[model samples]
Target chain A: MNPVKVIINKELKVIFNSLLFYIAFTVFFCTTGFIYWLSQGNIFYTGQASLGYLFTVFNGVLFFLIPALTMKSISTEKRDGTFQLLFSKPIKTWQLLAGKFFAILIQVLLCLALTLPYYITIACLGHVDHAVGFCGYLGLIFTTGCYISIGIFVSSLTSNPLIAFFSTFAITIWFQFLFEMLSSWLGNTFIASVFMYLSVNDHFDTISRGIIDSKDIVYFISIISLFLALARYVICKSRI
Target chain B: MNVIVKDLTKIFDYQKAVDSLSFEAKKGEILGLLGPYGAGKSTTLKMLAGLLRPNQGSIHFDNYTYEKNESKIKKLIGYLPEKNPLYDAISVTDFLFYMAKLYDIPRYKVTSRVLDMISLCGLENEKHKLIKELSKGYRQRLGIAQALIHDPEVVLLDEPTTGLDPNQTFGIREIIKTLGQEKTVILGSHILSEIENTCDQVMIMSKGQIMAQGTTAELRQAPNSDFSLKIVIKGGEIPAIQEALNQLPQIKSLQLQHKQEFEVHCTPGQEIERAIFELCKDNDWYITEMTPVQMRLEDIFRKVTQKQ
Candidate 1:
């Protein structure tokens, strides 16, 4: 494998070797299953089942899980002094960030995969919109990518993993809830529309409702790329 | 593999870590950086490895400037930082392979090259173990193994034996001695004896500047006005012994401060001992031991830095 793939593999191995990834996976699965069961009422949603509920549930769950997964991306490297060793080599800064970012992607994917049993249950119970469910998953992935990128950027800012986790969790939660709180203050003005539109929760909610708007997809991709770029810049400057 | 550092300087807030420092290392030769703590040794090494940009100077590797050919320079160089930077959870084998991959070594070749490095550093049995579980000596070996995995042309080791036990120190010293046979090596340490034993040349750094740079023979030959001689005297009046030794013909000047001791300065290479022996024969002030105290590297470092 090339350096990027090699680094990705190394990081994946490290993530799997630790018990944190498993813990995050178990918690996400248990919570999503419980919520799905509760939302079913006594008959477990005999009507058409939509993926929107799953998206909402996972969004809340990722608010905690993403920070847990990405808190050590750069912080652990710095604390262990391994950052200097990596910098001394011939590889560029962007490759390392991409490698680590993809590693976090694999973990998020695994957590999503653990919900397979829930998907099977949904398919067995009643009619479901398979296309909308797939699109909803694509949207969840897009938003989670943005969250992990933001988390990685926050991780690069400090060597303390707890601080990285808290900062990332706080920023993600703030971005998700800021506009809702802003609307109450602005009294539903036109400016509140822009704030609400800019919020990640708003964009994710729009896409999870079986609507594939280009603008929502673009917003998620751009936010992820921007944070990943910032993370690259931060690590480069700090390494030098 | 030649390195030229010109007027390099780095200032941190109120202190200059490297202050107009300049030096050069020739191809296939070991250059020892000797200095006490806070003497800019680590800072200088960091700049050389391109991990830090100098504040006010240029570094050139061969004919290429450091900035213009950073990737090329990094490919040709291997650096072992003062603090051993190994991932605790990574096995020795995996770490070496990771570094080799970074250097663009072929996938099929990385394994054999890694094995060669492990063997060269005598880390064969511990190659499968996690780095954090290894003893300090073994961890140091792994550090060297990683640095040499790609077989870079220039290897810079900072305090490679700083915390190792005596046997470990000897092992590191031996590896360095062998590495010097094929690759140009630069090591930074405050231990003067290690430099004297392993390096072909020494550069003494102090307060962000190089005080002296030369081979041991060349440094010993630097002009000095005074030479020390430790002479043991047999039973005799201390005053008489000093008086007899002062009358030697080759002595330019003499001082009789102690009863049995006297400090004498003479022309370089002049033999004043014969005259002293002749003068002392009558009084039976036998000379027990005669040794010349020439200027050493430590003396030069202390004298130059103290003057600064």
Candidate 2:
């Protein structure tokens, strides 16, 4: 087997064996379901056939949920000294990072796949815009991928899972909110546009609006790869 | 895999963890790194295992060095770090299989290798169980099994038996001694008995530097071997034995331990047992007690570490 496959197998096995993934799966869909169906600002109250509120609220729920799913992937390894064991093998640091990233992605993907019933139910209820819904799900996946990368990077920086969690939450929220706020505060200058282009929400909003701009696609891909690269950098530099 | 480490240095925050550490280890022999805590044993092993990049110098295993062919060198070496970190959530067999695959063993060989390791590490009973369920000793066995899953030519063990009970230590030592017969095993530990019983060649380190390097016998000879042999000659003339011992040039100092009992301090690299027997036979003395002084490792450790 490839080194990356070996690591991915162990990490995925752990996710399946542990209660964390199950708990995250349960809590995520439950809250998203209750908010979209039972709350005062629910789909029934909005009286809209489109899943605009559903996707928007799901993004809010995932903002916290994805970090919870990924916070322990790298931090616990460092805490248990498995990081040393991993590097001792015939594998590069990037292989380990990639394996972990894919493991978190698989877990998140499974949880999202389970939410398909909600999409099907909403479609049955009324005429939902299928293209917009597809783009919305795509945006969620990309946004979650970027969040998972940040979570893995923060986890690599410290051995404490709790620290990894808070830092992931703080930095990701900052990445989502702080850049947009700065861009607005700076007015419509080219510099402000750059910050706007870098904000995760900006690209997510663009794709979720049924417009697949190449620039927004590049932004999401670049941020996900950037944070993964940052994770690789920290792990390699610490050995020196 | 023959190994040579020259001027290998690792500095952590301006403190030299390993300073100009140099040693040679031949294939199919155990080279024990004997040192106290903070003596840089782990650091040196880390560098050799390619886990930690050295600040300076070269490590040549066959022809592989840290600067070049690092990944290939990594494939050829296996390391079990201190504390023996393992995936507690996974079964022992699965963990070994994962390690075997990471080492890029042929797909067909992984199953046989995992099974071979299971029996080799004496972990047959726990093979299907979660690693968290095993005792510390069994976990250590699993750790060693993973390290050897790839059958690397070089195996570096860092304090492999420091925390185990006597029984577990014995099991681990037996495994390592067996490996020593076929692999270039570099074991690091502060435990003297572990090193003494398991390693043929020893490198004693202190404060990030090797203080003594050679076979234990060669190292033991360094403190001048000023050891006294107490001989109790029953009914033998004390003056006669003293005169005979005094005549021998090997005796550095002599004293009367008791009536008919003599203590002789022989210089290093000298054999005086035959001479004493010759004197006793000549005098027809019935010798009751003759005890040769033994060199203790604690004394050598102190002498080397203390620079005395």
Candidate 3:
């Protein structure tokens, strides 16, 4: 079997067997249901039951849950001394890193797949543009990928899962919010542009709104690549 | 296939762990790297295993050099670190299978090979259980199983039997002996008795350098030196015994150990047994036993390490 498949299978098995995954899944479903119900009641701003809006809210929930799921991908291995076990094998460093990255990505994809009923309900209730909904799901997955990369990088930093989660959460929030704050004070167009572009929120927002801009796609891919590369470098240096 | 290490040195920070240590392990021979704590045994093993790049030195297996061909070197050797790091979540069978995969073993043969290894290491009962649930001994067996899963030619086991009980230690020693029959094994440990019991040739190391390297017999029996003999006799007169032994020009020094025992350290150019028999023939000293005191590993180690 391919080594990545070996890692993916192991990660997926752990993610499925874990109680935290079930808890996250249950809470995610409950909040999505509540949000869908609230939108149905026509709250402020003439709330419409759009799949795109549900996806937007779901993305916000994922900002917490996805990190919770991925924080242990590498951290647990190091804590349990399994990372060293893998290194002693004849496998190369890149194969191991890619295996872990894809394994976490598979879990995120599974959790995202469970939310399909929300999209189906939106289609039944109102005129939901299928292409826009599809694009929104794609954008959510891309954002989840970016979050997973950051989570992996954080996991590489420490062997404690709690520390991994909090550090990743803190860094992701900084990337999402600090850039906009910087844009207001800097006033320079180039500086503001750089800050906005660096923010994952900015790119995710554009892609989720059905505009498949090449730059946004490139940005998410680059973020995934850069963080994963950084994770590989950190792990190698740490001699794990 | 002899393995050669020349000027092997590994330093961490300012501490020199292994300094210019050199040795060789001949084919089908177990070279025991004996040393106390912080004596650079593990560092030398790591350098040989290609896990740590040496600050200076080169390791060559027959014709292939470690620095020039790492992949080939790695392919030829298996290393068991002091800490038997195994995946706790995976079963013994799966871990061995994973090792086989890493070594690029054929897929069709992985199952049977894993089974053979499982049985070889006496891991049949715990083969299906996760490694974390197994006892320390079983975990160690699992570690050895993985090390030999690929069947590497040179296996460097660092304290393989560290935490094992007597029974488990014997089992591991048997496994190692079986491996040593066909493969070159370099085992490092501070246990002098284990090395003396298992290894054919021993290398006593200290202070990041090898103090001595030779077989037990070769080390103890220094050439051109007086042979020491400890004799057991049924009670006898001390003056008469001393006079009889002192008559021989070869017997330079003699001392009584106890009521019935005596030790004779002879000068150069003395055949000890001939002189003792001739003395006993002329003067009737009933010799109950005559045995040569063989040097133990402890004595050899102390002598070599304490020397300048």
The prediction achieving the highest lDDT against the true structure is 2
lDDT of 3 by residue, B132-189 (tens): 8999999998888888887889988999889789999999999998988889999999
* CA deviation > 4 Å runs, candidate 3: A31-46, A185-189, B62-68, B222-228, B233-287, B306-308
Give the per-residue lDDT digits (tens) of candidate 2, residues B1-308: 89999999999999999999888999989999998899999999988888888889889998888788988888889899988999888888888888888889999998999999999999989899998999999999988998998898999999999779999999999999999999999999999999999999999999999988888887777666467788887755667767877988878888887677777888755668877778778778767888976676767887788882
Q: Write the per-residue lDDT of candidate 1 for residues A165-215, one digit (tens) a residue.
A: 999988898667876678657886899877776688888887777788999
Q: Tell me the tens digit of each residue's lDDT in model 1 across B1-308.
A: 78888999998876899999888888778899999899999999988888888889988888877768888888888999899888887788887877898888888898899989988999989988887789999988888888888888888999999888999999999999998888889999988878888999899888988887789777666666355565667678776676666667677777653555566767666767776677668777687766666776777767766777
Residue B193: error of model 3 in Å? 2.3
The lDDT of each candidate is: 0.83, 0.87, 0.80
Stretches of model 1 off by over 4 angstroms after superposition: A38-48, B242-275, B278-284
Candidate numbers, best TM-score first, in rank order: 1, 2, 3
Ranking by DockQ: 2, 1, 3
Q: After aligning candidate 1 to the native by TM-score, how far in Å is the CA of B155 from where it should be?
A: 0.2
Clashing pairs in 2: none
Q: Tell me the chain A TM-score of model 3.
A: 0.92
TM-score between candidate 3 and the true structure? 0.88
**Which segments of candidate 2 are over 4 A away from where they belong?**
A189-191, B233-264, B269-287
For all predicted structures, in order, the TM-scores are 0.93, 0.92, 0.88
Candidate 3's residue-wise lDDT over A42-129, tens digit each?
Answer: 2224556566567767788888887787788788877876665566566666788788888877777777788887777767777878
lDDT of 3 at A235: 83
The predicted structure with the larger DockQ, 1 or 2, is: 2
